[model samples]
Target: MSAAAPSAQPKLRVKNATKAYNTRSGELVAIDRCSLDVKAGEIVSIVGPSGCGKTTLLWSMSGLHKLSSGEVLLDGKPVNGPNPEIGMVFQDANLLPWRNLDANINFPFEIKGTKPDRAWIDDLLGRVGLSGFGGRFPRELSGGMQQRAALVRALSFKPSVLLMDEPFGALDAFTREEMNQLVEEIWMAAPTTIVLITHSIEEAIFLSDRIVVMSPRPGRVAAVHDVPFARPRSLEIMSTREVFDLTNVIKREIVGEQKSRYVRSSDAPVAQSAV
Candidate 1:
């Protein structure tokens, strides 16, 4: 038999990543020896309980936060600081109050000392349903519209990897669903590697190729699930039985971690009293 071809290297790799902070009490570990790998053009979502270091992991992947140990690599090269190939979208729109939508979207180009692509920018705005509204300021747009602009801003530079941290957490249910659909459409149109941090199990199932569930504080990867659904998924798919079951499975992982933490804390006092 002929030798099988080797697997392709991951587009992004997190090797035994550990992040910590020095506070008044001492060192605080946020993520403990967590590692992950993302293939090219893959959409991966990380879901966990609150304060489980989901944001910290995302930030480390973006090179915005320095890991206390191990390393993050993009295309096999270490990412020690912000790189043009990586783009980030935070929970807030964070658009410049004074700059109009067009200018705000072009801000990355300005920082990179490159000229903005007007045609591409127009197409992005159109795809996100903000075609002619580019000339308006952020104050003139609604929450969803502002977020659409923020998404465009991150994509304006055509980064290879996009890191999103609860980008739609502030939106209403209806709006959030719409934004999710919009994200699916955009991602289909232009396939970019994406790593998303979200608390919503349904959102993770609706948007990701795979889902990574993290444990409570000092977060570690509790479980990793490959979404069985095919691409170009619609919002109606969220109502299916398979999706419901998968959502519950992911939810149990998070809730189980929370319960374990509670048990550990509760048992500590009893053991001390027994002594």
Candidate 2:
């Protein structure tokens, strides 16, 4: 028998990753010596308290933010600039109100000086359950529908990795849940390594293969949990004991970080300046 082809390598590897910010007050580190490896076709979610630098980490990985130290490798290559192999989805959808759904989804193609692939756009929209709404503008579509279009547009290029930052945070609870299910279904249809940053433990558990819990300001990796759940997951699974166990574990990590942060703040010496 012929030898089977080797499987592709992991999509991203972040090692000794450190990111810092400079301010008039002083320099502050956002991410300190954090590291994680993302395998091909796996969904990873980074969750942490406010100001924990989850967004910073994602932007650094995406090449939008330059790291102060360490490395972010995508497909064995350093991520120093925009790479077409990656696509990003943000919280606001950022779709132009003037553009119709099809036009908006095809915007990426247009920017590349390529003609809008109508059939392709239609196919993607159909997959997101917005089959007949292509002609509607962003104003006409509900929050969830707008998000679906945003995701379809991000995938229009068939990127190997998708980076999302709280893409459903602006939606209502019901809409967010529906959008989450839609994303999971989309992942089933077309597998891609995804890195998502979310504030909700439920959303993280619902969508992630691994939950990377982050520490408070000057964040570090506090814990990395391999979700003990099977694929094709649904909201129904959230009610299970196993699901609660995982969720509770993640929540405790965040809470622990918060408590530690408060204690540190309480013990800090008063600020002083010399003339």
Candidate 3:
């Protein structure tokens, strides 16, 4: 058969997206005038400071958090709340102790009252190198294995968009690298539009087609760099000069934003319509 047709256009698009928190006194802004576009099958990584609203932006895109003013559209339709087409992978694996790998992977379908695709699930298990681990509980597996299972659970639904918030952040350096490679493999297998939030500039450069850098506090697109590394990118690329250059560029951009730390706490939500 000829090569399969490419996935749909702009699987996840966030235009003029903004989000703020409502407290006892006034609105506390998180993301400010943030706009992003993720085409079908593209892996985009967002890098920013701790309080720069990176997680808030990802949550808004997933419709888990309400936007202060802007709109997040999935395939052109506005995402008002928790859209099933998007799957979120949080920092922690958060696997159920009572469940095995297969059960954990199938949990989403179970809760939705939708039948699990057995064949797909099996193939996914194999793809993640957890074929025989299906029957094993979370306690029995290694940390990496638990993360692998957690990832399969988020991916089993075949979401149009994958929202990842530093899923490998808690792992050791070696495990983190392994998980990054696994992420690349998983992306190649199913090709969902992916948005990853991470502090590792090297990881971002290694795994993403583009890196979107954001400023501190009032987060906005500080800069966007396009990575032109060829496909099937190896782990060796992480050690090369290319990686350092890219990391340096991103680091400089992130550091440049720190010049203005005099943020007023009373600044009521600056218009963030395009989160």
Candidate 4:
């Protein structure tokens, strides 16, 4: 294991968590007996194949979904429902069409009927490079800019944890890269524990302090890798042999787990056809 965080207790813990749904066929287990810890001020990326419960885990972390077994705890408190300290940014911008960027970013406070510190929001806008665009509508922005706004909106509450579900998955390659850099910048400016669910290996490597690799469906912790690079990392680090080797190691683990899954399915007995 990598060196423990300076603090004694984890900021977030997912312990033996399992999530399942009762379907027509049977119980569908999305995640099984998964356990992990994220330290305060850390950025952790959860990467896995589709149907591997990456999003399920994100929901659990955010207190939006309850686990079938075990639990997710934030600051030693159980996450049984949507907690105020947690903020989520989904795959889509999910912006209200009629609301201007400033209004949309302030929507969270509006719902709570709470007044927010406009100065903080302004600082965030500047940090995310959206300083002057707050008056613009969502439609006026490009895909990347819209997503950047989405991120700022999530942070406007100053939540302790930010749960991102493939926020850049829909963007073009260049836009995605730009957003990745933007995320790093934002995190550095104002630290928060972040849990990002993504399929991009390079993105994970670039943004995370640690990368948690999940197994195939009924996902479990396949491996946990502590990113060796120093923070305020740049895209140049992606070209190094160390990054390449680490990427290959994760790929092999996923591939190997998939092969095992195929073998198990093939070994199951087939039902005989009726006469």
lDDT of 3 by residue, 66-155 (tens): 888878888889999988899889888889999987788878988898988888877888887898888899999988888888888888
Where does candidate 1 stray beyond 4 Å?
1-6, 269-275
What is the overall TM-score of model 3 with all chains considered together?
Answer: 0.89
Residues 117-215 of candidate 4: C-alpha lDDT, one tens digit per residue: 899989888887899997899999988889989998899989999999999999999999999998888888888999999989999999999999999
TM-score of 4: 0.94
Candidate 4 positional error at 46, Å: 0.3
**lDDT for residue 193 in candidate 3, whole number 0-100:** 84
Roughly what TM-score does model 1 have, to 2 decimal places? 0.94
Tell me how far the alpha carbon of residue 225 in candidate 2 is from the true structure, in angstroms, after superposition.
0.5
Question: Where is model 4 more than 4 Å wrong at Cα?
Answer: 1-7, 269-275
Candidate number achieving the greatest lDDT relative to the actual structure: 1
Ranking of all candidate structures by their lDDT, best first = 1, 4, 2, 3
> How accurate locally is residue 185 in candidate 1, as Cα lDDT from 0 to 100?
89
TM-score of 2: 0.92
lDDT of 1 by residue, 1-275 (tens): 00113487888999999998887656778999999999888899999999889999999999999999989999999999999999899898989989999889888998999988888888998899999897899999999999999999999989999999999999999999999989988898998899999978888999999999999878899999989787788888999999999998988889988888888878786522321
lDDT of candidate 2 over 1-275, digit per residue (tens): 01113465557988888998887777778889889888888899999998888998998888898888898999889999777888999879989899998788878887888776677667888788889887899999888888888999998888899999989989988988888888888888888889999988999989988899999878899999988677788789999999888888889999988897777676764322200
Give each model's whole-structure lDDT: 0.90, 0.85, 0.83, 0.89
Query: How many steric overlaps are in each model, in order?
Result: 0, 0, 8, 0
